[model samples]
Target: MAEDLVLDTAIRDWVLIPLSVVMVLIGILRYFVSKLMRSSPAPDAKMVKEGQVIIRARNLKSGANFIPPRSFRTRRLYYSNEENGLLHVPKGQGTNPQAQMFSDPNMAMDMMKKNLSMIIPQTLTFGFVNFFFSGFVAAKIPFPLTQRFRSMLQNGIDLSTVDVSYVSSRSWYFLNLFGLRGLFSLILGDENAIDDTQRMMQMGGLGFDASKSLSAEKDGLDIIQHEWALPRFEQRAESVLRKLVK
Candidate 1:
């Protein structure tokens, strides 16, 4: 805790630099590993047909108010009719659509693969770093860290009385895990490397909710209520003509 006790400057070259570089390298490697292992399901006839139907439905709903009420009704019935509709999808044959979405085999497998791609390398990296770099003080935070952060920031260092400013090599590695976005972008370009911060946020529920997205989309599609605006077109035109005459 003493201001007089400064960490040797060589620690930056030996510990901080190497650890940061290694963490970055590992991330790049992880990206390729994920890409190689990632076997995204190809869009087949059923999926493509369903997707096109959904797109058409969405376009129709967006522009529904611009068309005549009768036209909108005809298109809605044509698309939503259960017996012959594109996505008619009979009611009560299964559980709620949202529940069905939850039990979907494809969704389950995709979730598993995504989680595995995230978990496996992180586990291996942390295990390897902790085993090799446990006790050494690796770097210092530019600012103060509270007691709450002590356990998280100081992973391997055991000095109970030491200042919380100094962090262990493993913790430093973890810091670089989320901190190297700019460096990665430079090395791997914009879309090449995954942004770990976004990934972490998603894992923590602060990011996009793909799990409920299908249900949300289905709900949106179900309630595409539109008020016909074209019905007022003639009235508005006549009013404009009267105003011009005056």
Candidate 2:
């Protein structure tokens, strides 16, 4: 009788424990999957162009990263002869870069001093809050899943006549993710980076005009991709502007 009771207890443990573990695993997986599905950003050809600009900008490193501390930087934008039609133009390859600024150091210092109160805290708060929430949301989503979703969704969406509004909507997920990561330099006290970021924002909207000129009616996925890549594009545009200004 004792042997039979022992065997029965062992069987109950094997069945109940495994079933509980499986259910818990399933629930956890579902929560993660739901968050991921909600965070996918639509992508297309226009997005590809924006991504290329970002890559080029990173190559240039236009913002304060190139400046020395206790010195301020100023830049101007102009059209380029070699790379005709790109919105953010750089200086000609052979030009003397330093001859452009004359007696502006004092002015620059005054401007920097005046902006310290607003710029520093504004940058820090913006960087920290944006990074924290965006990072949390990003941590819950996966790019692999977003890419897969893009493939599936692309089939149903019209490729032509896509407007900026829809494109922006699709990219809202990505805006909530890496957009946060991009804000960290300021909260960590990188003034140069913040200066660079402000310059990029001040520049004209990232090539939306160029896109509109090239295509009268862009497709939905194309718009989503284009808008999604704006942060990177802005960075690239600043580099182009810096070269022209110098």
Candidate 3:
């Protein structure tokens, strides 16, 4: 077994603390930059109507048992009706996403701004860490970690013999980048733009497909076997009342 390296206190002071502080400061800077660059486009009326229809369908599906059978059936029919229903999008009627993006220059601009805000600072920070603190063992984790954690925690360090608990400065930067989400949330509130993970997920996800979403909600509403619960509740209430009287 490879012995653990004794990390210097100066390494923690100069590399670990400064790197973490830089990451936090960068996150704050990114949040404000994104806020300044964000554009609020007027929502399309049809899109708003479609979104509300989906919300109503979802509510109906979740609360189907609570409402009367007649009301449930009526609500389901309003959305899932084969003809003239809110959720029924005609075949071949879905808008091409590329075309939509092309048609709206403001949307494209907003996307560009978001990308710039996310990418530029990250690239700069990464370069700064690599240039200054590369291969420096910054700190050691308190708990034992498996060998699988080597690549994750020891980034920029080429030494395969080093234990996984020793975190390199570059990896420390990344750890602070992702791990400070809760700290950023506490400082900047829950909805702040400091979360890189959320931004990455948003970048990966397909933007809202209205037709597909509506179709899915319609299918979900159609399959639900709603049973009214009021009668069961009434019986239970009567039983409780009788017990109280006795």
How well does each candidate superpose onto the true structure, as a TM-score? 0.69, 0.19, 0.81
Residue by residue across 129-182, what tens digits does model 2's lDDT show? 344322111111222233334422232234433221222222332333234333
Locate the minimum summed-lDDT window of 10 residues in model 2: 72-81
Per-residue lDDT of candidate 3, residues 92-162 (tens digit): 99887667877888777878878888889889989998998888989888888999999999988899888
The RMSD of every model to the true structure, in order and in angstroms, is: 6.2, 25.8, 3.1
* Candidate with best lDDT: 3
Q: How close is candidate 2 to the true structure, as a TM-score?
A: 0.19
- Judging by TM-score against the true structure, name the best candidate: 3
Q: Ranking by TM-score, best first?
A: 3, 1, 2
Whole-model Cα lDDT of every candidate shown, in order: 0.71, 0.35, 0.85
The TM-score of predicted model 1 comes to 0.69
